[model samples]
Target chain A: MNKKIKTYYLLTAFTIFMFGFSYMLVPIYEVFCEITGLNGKTGSINSTLVIEKPVERFVRVQFTSNVINSAPFKFSPGKKEMVIQPGKIYTTFYTLTNQSNQPLLATANPSITPGKYAEYFKKIECFCFTHQQINANETKELAVQFIVDKKLPSEATSLVLAYTMFDITKQLGYKLEK
Target chain B: MNTDADHLHEDHKTGIMRWITTTNHKDIGTLYLFLSLTMFFVGGAMALIIRAELFQPGLQLVNPDFFNQMTTMHALIMIFGALMPALVGLANWQIPLMIGAPDMALPRLNNWSFWILPFALGMLGSTLFFEGGAPAAGWTLYPPLVLQGGDALPYAIFSIHLLGLSSILGAINIIATILNMRAPGMTLMKMPMFVWTWLITAFLLIAVMPVLAGAVTMLLTDRFFGTSFFTASGGGDPVMFQHIFWFFGHPEVYILILPAFGVISTIIPTFSRKKLFGYDSMVYATASIALLSFIVWAHHMFTVGMPLAGEIFFMMTTMLIAVPTGVKVFNWIATMWKGSMTFETPMLFSLAFIVLFTIGGFSGLMMAITPVDFQYHDTYFIVAHFHYVLVPGSVFAVIAAVYFWLPKWTGKMYDETLGKTHFWLTTIFVNITFFPQHFVGLAGMPRRIPDYAVQFTDFNAISTIGSFGFGIAQILFLYILYKTLKQDVTADNKVWEGAEGLEWTLPSPPPYHSFEEPPKVE
Candidate 1:
């Protein structure tokens, strides 16, 4: 009987451990992404990898921008495309207009087409990494400074950097109403 | 120690109150079975509604959104509510009796596990009344889309948590009872296949159910607590949700079917008048299948865009599962190879389970070829694959078990003619309903859509008619069960001529506390 009770306790403890392991997968998944670069999740550039010799090759980078339907904003790329030499820095901007009557808090999410280029597409400075607040009917320009790594795979000739802007204000507005 | 017959009068109550308050394993088992049967009808109704809408294609019975809700709710109720609970119900009744134990190791916990289900199901069923209707994101509950759903999301999450808790507790009790409460000298290897299958299944429940709990908890936090666990915009990956979900979801498929293996293992041998051909190998095969279940989860996500290496690894592992599964099937066939055979409802169901489940298995193999899955993913072919496994594989086995054991359970004979009729109708209609799905899927009709291209019209109509036929057959099943319960043509201890097991040693309609004094096994 005592043994049975002890086994029960042990099994219960194992269940609790599994509960912890479920949460542990969050960090585990992040680490796995960092290692495999799966899902186009990018890693921050450190000076250590920048020591590679620059290549003379040029890659055409096109910019695409759009706003979600529920988010009352107009967004477009300042320039449609730019040709940059591999291992060189390039700068671009996107124009945003708040079409709503109230102030809007917007955040931009970035994705690179073909996915393989996401790891090599390094952002030195970008509005996507920060939050922007625009007054009612206000227009604003956001800058994105980036570098194409020398290690960008040889088969990658072109890339599309797409940014989708979400209005957090309206998202939170529904919450406040609730 | 009192013999079972001597203790027949031991304060056993007979009424609704007895069911509500009783801690006896048998009472709890009965509760679980009745609840599961009720849910089977409810889920089946939802399936019929889905078929009715999809019958002629373009928005026939329901709009697209409500149609999505029906598909989603139908899966949830049938998998969690009907099939799982029924297996657990069978385990509760059979395990103790088969092992020569008086009752489960933890009776009160057993009662608690059974009782939590009704409330969980109530919470789940009530989601249909919510403003957005019940969880239109399908049972996968993938985020971003799922997050857009209204009040039903939270209710669905809560119900899942309750259901997971119930299954976990039930698993713990089964483990404890099997490990600690076995009759002296029965020995681990000597234990019956049903007990062995359930023993492994309990471990599976313990392992993966918590992962499901974890996944749903993350979803809950993401929805209500402003956490970004699955919000890709906030440094979280939405695909990670699929990874975690199928981690639980893959094994969940096995949890639904392994008991069916046990049921078939038992029935095949009895009808063949032989001991199971490869008893030891069957045990090893079950363990192998359980072990392989963990590594092969990503097969379900083949179309989710995994890396080539990850795809190859998952594809290989998924294909590897067929080996042990084939072992189980081969052993069943070998058991019935040359022995004297009979075709009762249970035996017929087992025979069909082997052939049809193999077809499902072959389709699963086709999907395992990573490139092939690209075409089959999210199509009716995928739907046909799982339904074949689940309906003929798991659900058929459950019905077979009930029919096989009904005489013992009720101490009366079910009408043989009616039983065989139910069996034949179910077999034919089940095939009719699901087989055409393969053609429609290969023709590229995506699932969960209420409206479809006119090209899919013919097959969809045939499938719907088949579903209605299958639905009517179950009503006959319900009537058969009812008639058996109401009448009392006393059954003998060994209900079948060739039956052999600890369970067959007991009186028909086993005493309220079976094996009050544990039987000594040779």
Candidate 2:
């Protein structure tokens, strides 16, 4: 009887452990991504690598900026387009204005197309790497320092660097309405 | 132990109160089975509605959104409500009897587990009445889209949580009972196959039910608590929900079917008048299938854009499942290879299970190739593959089990003629309904859409007619049940000559309280 009761307790404990493990899968997935270069894929790069190397190969890099619908913010690229040599650093500024009364936190998610060029298009320093908090009625200039590595394929002629601004205030526990 | 308090409690066994408060294994088993039957029709009605809408190129019976609800509800009520509870009902009745134990290890918890289901299903059904109607995100309830649903979302999530909790508790009780309450000298290897299959299934429930609960809880938090577990802007990827969900989802597939394997294993040997071929192997194969279920989850997400290596790995593991599953199928065939055979309703169902489930298996294999699945994904082919396995595989086996054991449970034989008639109609219509879905799927009609291109009209009409045929045929089953309850022929203790096991030795319509002192098995 005693042994039977103990087995019940042990099985109950195992059930609880599995419940917690389901939540743990989030971090576990992130770690798996890390091991597999999920964080490295088109995310960030060493600026010194870009500053030290220079190549004569030039690629047309176009910038497109947009914000989520009803996000109450005006956003655009300071320069709509540019052509830069591979392995050469270039800076582009994005202007963001908070059009609402409440201070808002937004994250600019970056995408590059044709998507295969993502690995070569590195963002050495970009406002997109972190969340940007804009005070009410505030305007901000966010700069992106990026380089196309020399390994970019020769046939690739054009790349679009697109940014979509997502309002993250409620998600971050800021307790504020967007 | 027969004190006055016990006697008073025993009196509760007769009236409506008996069902509400009793904890007896057989009574609870009956309750589970009845719930299964009721929910099967309920879910089946939702299926008919889905078919009615999809009967032609344009919407007919319901609007698009409501049509989506029908598909979602049909899957939920069928998988969680109908098939799962039926298996649990079988376990509640058969496990203790097979092992010579008096009852389950935890009776009160067993009662609680059974009771929670009705309320949970009720809450989920009420979601249809919510201001915007029930969740129509399909059963996967993928986020971003699912979050857009109105008042029904929270209710649906809560109902899922309750269902998960109920299954988990039921699993714990089954595990404890199997581990601790076996009759002396029965030995683990000597136990019946149905019991063995359920023992593994219970563990699966324990392992994955919590995971499902956690997944739904995360959905709730993402919806209400402002957590970003599935929100991209909150540094969370919505695809991660799929990963977590299928982690539970794939095993959930096995959880539905493994017991059907047990039921078939139990039925085939009796009707064949032979010992099961490779009994030990059947045990090992079931375990192998369970172990493999965990790693092969990503097969469902092949079209979801996984990394190339991940796709290759998932495809390989998914293909590997065919090996053990093939082992189980071949063993059943070998058991029936050259023995005196009977085509009783149960035996017929089991045979059909082998043939049709293999077809489902073959289609699953077709979808296992990453590139192939990209084409088959979310199409009628996906619907056809799972329905073949689920309807013919799991649902058929449950029907077989009930027929195989009905005489034993009622102390009266059901009308074999009517039984076989029910079997034939069901078999014929089930094929008519699901077979066209394969061609429709390969023809590239996506699922969950209320209407389709006119080019796809013929097959969809045929499928709908088949579904209604299948639907009406079920009424005969209800008639057969009603006749059985009004039984005139009393069944003998050993109902079938080839029957083996402690359950057969016991008198038909086993004592309300049985094996109280435990039978010694050697």
Candidate 3:
């Protein structure tokens, strides 16, 4: 009888430990994700590069775009969509634009889906890659230059680069979209 | 002290007033069973309506809102009104007898628990006629959406609070009775596994009911009091609600199934004509499963952007559960191996339960794989998984329990022919209703939608037809129950040759107040 009671108590202690452990683990994991970016950052993907190459071999493509928000936006084109041979790097003209009504108040939120490719794509000097703001109706353009890796697969064609323009003013509930 | 003849003519008149005001275990058990049966039919009818709506997918029978209400009400009714109450009814009837006590430890509390159910379910069911409608949010009552539901929300929440309170109190009563009121010679280890399982289940209820109460309270406060506890705009996370809900929710699943485990344990031994193999191991396994239940909450939330570490931890823990669960399945099969088995209706249901529940368990394991669950979550696969466990696993055990005990309770034999008919109809139709759901879910059909796209229509039609057939089949159970109550038939004191228990020591249809002096346990 005493043994039964002892076993019961031991089981009770075990159950309590498990319950507490379950509650603690969730927040701990959230912290890990925050520190490691192990699952890739949420809402953190922002650059759109359109490459247009009319002819094959080495071709030059000009990039153009309008920026309506406050952050500086830049685009680089590799070989254009029409002509790009496998294992070749073509000089592509890069364009940068900035349209902001005021200094940016909100930080850039970047995210990626199908979360398998975070290592392959690296971002630098991006308007959304970091926090920056342009003055109201301020339009500025810059060039981004890059070469498509010769080792890049032929099947890696026509990638979609998307940039969502978030309004910091509207986030604060004021109409700033001109 | 007394001879058999003197005992036979002894004044058995416990007056009408005794029944009305009684705290007697047997009386309370009778009331609970009858009430649950009534609720079962009511809930079953609601299911028929849902099936009728999905009969051909284009709103054949009811509007979308009404269809939602039917689905919601059906789940609410089955989980609370029917299955839980029925198990409690069995507990009321058997716990004392099995333990050699005269009644529950806290008898008044038992009555209160039983009586509160009707009012709670009444409040819940009456919401169908309310200005908005019955709770359309699925039984999980996930917020942000449930908050958008109007006046009926409070009624539903109030009903849930009442139900949870009743369950908590019932658990307390069971715990007290098992811990404090066993016969002098009945030690903890010697206590029936049914009693032991319920003891653990009661502990679970006491621990989690408050959490559920707190969760629903937060929901109410958020909706009415402008609390931002779950609002994304006010720095509260919507995902936090899932965390809290599943915290209480996972254990709630065990609360439904543990008693069924008890029932299966009881039936398997009786029919197999053998002592339950590894009784101590069975007890340990039940405890392990209950302990593991707490950590497994996150398995249900793999798609909610849970961190990879959290996902792996939950996945591994959830899978670890199958070890003990597999032990139980193996134990049951071994118990039955080469034993002279009979095909009585109760035994038949129990046999079916062993096979079907294992199938459910495998699917559950399949769902626990985090990557695979990403495809299965919130889809028909999930729907199929639970229904498999719930319908055959829990519901079938409840039926088997009823059949096993009916003769002992009523002192009359149920028509075996009719019972077998009911079993076959239920078994066939239940599979038909839920099996195709797997294919549809794999084909990417999400659950809780009132309508579906045309391509998925065929499987939906087959499932809906099965649902209707299963719904109508339950009327046979009702008829059998009615016939047994009205007819006269004799049952022997030892109801079955293989049956073993203190309850079997008494005359069939035990006296209104049994073991006024507690019986000695061997």
Candidate 4:
């Protein structure tokens, strides 16, 4: 009987430990995702590189934007399309307008597809790299600077880069609206 | 030690209180079985609604939201409420008797475990009337979508939490009873296959149930507390939820089926009148299957956008499960190879379980190939695959266990003719209901929708009719049970001619206590 009682406690403790471990999986996964960029995330580049005597390989880049969760914001690229050389840097701007009555905190996640081409699409600087905060009825200009790698497979002619904006005010513990 | 007096004393309570307060293993087993039966009908009705709505598509019977709610709730009720509890009921009733123990190691906890279920389920079932109706987000409760659910979400999560607690406690009791309460000479390897399978299952429940709790808890907090564990906007990845949930969810499939494996392993040999073929291998196979379950979870997520290497790895590991599973199937057939087999209702159901579950397994193998799953994922093919496994696989085994043991428990022999009628009706309609799903699914009809294209109409109509037939057959099952009890025809001590076990040594409907004194095994 005493032995049974002891086993009971041991099993209970194991259950509790697994419960806490479940929460721990979140952080562990986040670390793993960051390292692997497993969830369509691209790494940030701190130093800008200048391509001299560039390959000048022209590739058509298409720009698009979306709001996740039906967030009350109108977001779009400054230009719908551009043709640029792969080895040289280019900058494009996007317009974000807060249509709601309250200030909002948002995050923009970017994806480039033909997803395999994402490896060659380098972003030296992009507004999607950080959170964006806009006040009520505020409109903001966002910039993206990138150089598509010349080493990108020759068969690839064009790539679509899209940005998805997410409502982060509730998730990040900020109550900016009534 | 005054062990008999301590274990076998009569309960002083009467009526509802006897059920509410009784700690006896058999009484609790009865409670769990009744609860599972009730939930099975409740969930089954929801399934009928789904089938009816899909009968000819075009939203004939219910609105899409209500339809989604039925689909979602049916899975929740069946998995957590019906199938799991039924297995536990069997464990509670049979474990002590088979092991030669006086009772479960923790009897009081056993009582608490059975009682918590109704309250948890009541909270769940009442959600139909909630503002904006019940959760339509499907059973996976994948977020961003589930976060859009109405007032019922919290109640559902809380119910799952309660269910998890009940399972853990029951598992602890089973483990303790098996480890410490076995008869003088019964060793671990020498224990019945049913006991061995359940012992492995208990470890699985202990290990994975909390992981499910954690996943649902994160969902709760994400909805209420603004935690971004799965919110993509807050740098939390929604796919992470899939990884976490399936980490628990894959093992959960085994948690439901392994005990069914235990039941099937027990039944086949008795009917064949032979010692279980490859008993040592069956034990090893079950353990191997349990271990394999953990690594193959990502097979469920092959389309959730994992890398090529990850996909290949998950695919390989998933296919490897076929080895042990095939071992189990081969052993059952080998046991029945040339023995004096009697096709009693239990044996019939067990035989059907093997054939149908293997069919389900083959489909499972088809989907395990990463490329093939990309085509099959979320299609009616996937639906067909799981339902084949779950309904005929788990549910059939549960039915088999009931037909096998109902006489033992009630001390009354149910009419064998009515029993066979239920079995044939079930086996025929179950295949009718789910088999065409593979046809429609492979031909490209998606699942969880209220409407389908005109091309898929015939198969869906046939499938729905089959479901109704299956549902009606169960009413006959109930009627047979009622007649068995009401007619008062007593069963013999050794109910079957070929039966052999510590359980058979005791009288039919054994005593208030499982054993008045522990009996020696060998």
Candidate 5:
């Protein structure tokens, strides 16, 4: 081939090779993404929290808690201090005793902030955030199981969990801190 | 025909201004190719920016709105700018040769079609730098949201109008040329596959361009006037807009792929050293695909809460299409079977096309299942599926056609080693970019999101890097094109030993006006 013809062939060959090479690269990169999760981090709940508690309760019981920086608390019991590690679920129990001479009623209410994120993290089975009636001198224990997000930043070290016990008769609420 | 006599007397000059002013089919084809090349680079650059943004997640390179614009424009550019124009380029260059016509039936109309594209794309691209940026509501342009765009909306809408007009005119010109300008002995059956494919494709264009024109015009009126074509509050159903749009849109897909089919049909037989298998069946299959396209519009709208009966009707019809498509595929394989196959660049690309496009077709079948589509809809999986079809399917066919015909067009042979190198690199990188998208979609990642939850970060990063590699690979294509035009390589009248068609009967770099005396056909 003449110099001009040689150049033409070289150029045409180069163009075809480039398109073919690019075509092959698509699947390889796909496999890399699946293996590395470099595109996005993937995590599933290592453990789920299960809680068992009695419905009726009486007495002024306060719940409060703090979470360590590495672990972000997803839930808390009414006015009790609890500690848990990241990637691990922990459960705590609290008992309330009715001391009034007559029948006494009490209830626990739960709520969270950053509402959208809370919707995904917080779990409740029933309408248990309302008041419950109890006979005088009755006793009950409330329990909750919860997991902290391991993906939480280390800078967010301490998380506050607070709960209040309310007397339905007097419309009085008591706060608990831990 | 008398058109040949007229073509002979037309002024054919040899300078740059001649190319700019010329109405000859050959000159217009050259113009279309050059224009599409420029747009290809422009669109490729936008895609690179999108990949860069997804490289590490978060708002790193651009804000969400701008990111959306990049994605939307990237799609529009590749589909409209790159694929459509390239096919038109091929049509301009090959249709007359295939039909044994001296020139296009309406040469001025051909020039009009070729000239309008630049202005249309210019208007569309200018919106990116304008106040409030380009149309960021994705290329689908679903109403209520698209109406919310600022100054860019009118520009984008008008640009679409121009593009539609250009396509309509081009279609009209093709129809006239094919119907009126065939060689004396050429009957419909005797016409080459490329010409037949374009004849059907052009009819489809005439039928649907008006629908698109009408739909977009209504959109313009809905935005600016008190018209309520798409506004839900105005008693017009928003869902109806999708119906009208996809009515034009589904056939639009066939419009893009059929010419590609024609190109591949021509290339595969030539390289395999065999006459095309089932020539009549191929013709019938093209017609079937085009006709089925009209009814399958509702498949795209299955998720929009259509009635069960409508869904089933559209679903079955869409699935039925696979039959004709399968016929085409089987015919291609049968053509290559037991033939003396050569591993030329064109043949290599054609072989890759058969395998890869079938994968695209299979995924499309999966989408045809309404229940399955619900899960895959609006996800990265859809992205992966279409790219497989468009990139390796239509786009690769165009490249193959270019390689197959470049020697004849330029009268020079291109470098084989570099061609193979480019091919291997592109084929590898393309899959890396789109394949992982399937996994990400299955993993619940949505499409069109600028940032994703941390879980999706890993795959997104890999896809992004792969995209960069794929984008840069096209530079090699440009280099090769430049080299071919600049060189003076000698080529025989029949560029490939197995090549058949009236085009090969002419000299290398065929005359501006060919077939002054139409040759006898057997």
Candidate 6:
């Protein structure tokens, strides 16, 4: 009977340990995803690359903007498309107007098309990394500084950089007038 | 320990409190069985609703959103609510008796484990009435779409947590009982196939149930706590959820079916009137299948656009599972080769299980080839493949086990003519319902949709009618079970003539305190 009770406790402890281990899988999976870019999760770099000479090959980079249906905002890219040399820095702008009666908190999620090139598309600066607040009828121009790595896969001649904006005012406990 | 004193002291308790507070294994086994039966009907009703709605192609019965909810909830209820609990009920009733143990190693925990199920299932079932009408994200509960689910998501998550806890506790009890409570001289290899299969299953449960718990917990926090573990806006990847989920999900499919393998293995030998041929190999085959289950999870995700190398690797590993699975099927056939055989209800189910489960296996092989899966993925073909394995493979085995053990448990013989009639009705109807799904799927009928293109209407109508027939046959099953219980005719101690086990040595409806002296095995 004592042995049985002891084994029972051992199993209980193992179960608890496993419960904690499950939380750990999140970070472990994140690390794996980052390392492999397994799900097109783009990586951030701390230092800027010095490409002494930009690549001569031109890739067509297109900008696309969308707002979730519930989000009361008008958003669009300043330019629809551009042809640029790889390894050279490029700047693009997006315009956002708060269409609601009150202030709103929002965030943008960025995705790259031909997902294989997401790892090579380095963002030196982007508004997607932080939350932005806009008051009633307020408008803002957001800047994105980026460069396509010369190592971007040759198959991806045309890349679409898309950002989807979402309204988070409700989750943060702000009221939206009906 | 005096056996007669223990029996008198234990059996005197009456009323609901006896069930609520009792620590006896048999009472808990009865509790588990009854709970599973109630859930079986609940889940079955959900299936009928799905079949009814899918009967026509023009969205006549339900909106697409509600249709998605029914499909999602139906799977959750059937897999977690009905099939798993039934197997646990069988384990609770038969494991101690077969191994000559007085009771499970942790009897109090056994009581707790069985009791947790109703609350979990209750919480899960309550989701249908929630403001969003239940979780519309499929049972896999992939994120982003699942993240968009309304009020039911948290309840679903909590219910899954409770269910995971119940399974983990049940598994611990099964492992402890099998390892420490076996009669003297019954080596691991010498244990009954049911016990062997369950032991492996418990380990699989222990290893994977926590993983499922973790996945759901992440979803809970992501949905409620503003965490972005799966939210792309917060730099988290949604596909990560699939990897974590199928890691648990693939083993879970095996978890559902391996015990069925044990049941089929037991029934085949008894009806063949021979020792199970290749017992050692069967044991090894079961273990290998469990191990193989872990790596092949990605076969379900072949359409996720994984690299060719990854796809090829997963495809190869998934196909390799056929080897051990084939070994199990061949051994069952070889056991029946040149042996005197009887076609009783149990044997009939087992024979059907071999042929039909192999067909499901071959379909699985078809999908494992990465290129072909592009056509079959998320189609009714995939649905047909798994249902063939689960409905006939797992569900049929559960029914076969009930018929096989009803005599022993009830101390009265079930009506054999009715039993055979129910078996035939079920076998034919089950095939009719699922077999046409393959054709419709091949004809490009996508799953989880309420409406379909007109071209696929004929097969869907046939499948729905077959489902209704299948559903009606089960009502007959319930009536037969009730009728058997009401009869006063007692069963023979050895109910099946060739059935040999420590369980058979005891009386029909074995005593309250079985194997009080711990009988020795040769």
TM-score of each: 0.95, 0.92, 0.77, 0.92, 0.74, 0.95
Point out the worst 10-residue segment of candidate 6 chain A by lDDT: A169-178
Question: Cα deviation of B169 in candidate 2 (Å)?
Answer: 0.7
Fill in the DockQ of model 4.
0.57
**Full-model lDDT for every candidate:** 0.89, 0.89, 0.75, 0.89, 0.75, 0.88
lDDT per residue for candidate 3 within A1-178, as digits (tens), equals 5543444454445445544554553466455544654444332323332234422433222232323343344323332333444233333332333343454333233333323332223333344432234444544432222343333333444322333343343334332333
Pull out the clashing pairs in model 4. none
Better candidate number, 3 or 4, judged by TM-score? 4
Ordered from best to worst DockQ, the candidate numbers read 4, 1, 2, 6, 3, 5
- Candidate 4: where is the Cα deviation over 4 Å? A44-63, A69-72, A78-93, A99-105, A112-126, A129-133, A143-161, A167-174, B1-11
Fnat for model 6 comes to: 0.47
The per-residue C-alpha lDDT of model 2 at residue B266 equals 94
Give one digit per residue, the lDDT tens place, for model 4 in B1-522. Answer: 565475446434778888888888998999999999999999999999999999996977799999999999999999989999999999999999899998899999999888889998888888999997888899999988998889999999999999999999999999989999999999999998889989999999999999999999999988888667887665567788899999999999999999999999999999999989999999999999999998988898888777788899999999999999999999999999998999999999999999999999999999999998999999999999999899999999999999888999989999999999999999999999999999999999999999999999999999999999999999999999899999878899888887878999988888776566679888
By summed lDDT, which 10 consecutive residues of candidate 6 chain B come out lowest? B3-12
Candidate 2 lDDT score relative to the true structure: 0.89
C-alpha RMSD for every candidate: 2.4, 3.2, 9.2, 3.1, 18.0, 2.5
lDDT, candidate 6, B236-314, per-residue tens? 7787788889989999999999999999999999999999989999999999999999888888898887777789999
Off by over 4 Å in 1: A49-57, A85-90, A153-157, A173-178, B3-9
Task: Return the lDDT, model 5, position A135.
Answer: 53
lDDT of 1 by residue, A1-178 (tens): 4766777888898888888888898899888776666666554776654545667788999999877655788999999999988776678899999987887778888878767668888888888835578878989999998887888889999988989887766444443221
Model 3 residue A52 distance off true place after TM-score fit, in angstroms: 44
* Winner of 5 and 6 under TM-score: 6
* Docking band of candidate 6: medium
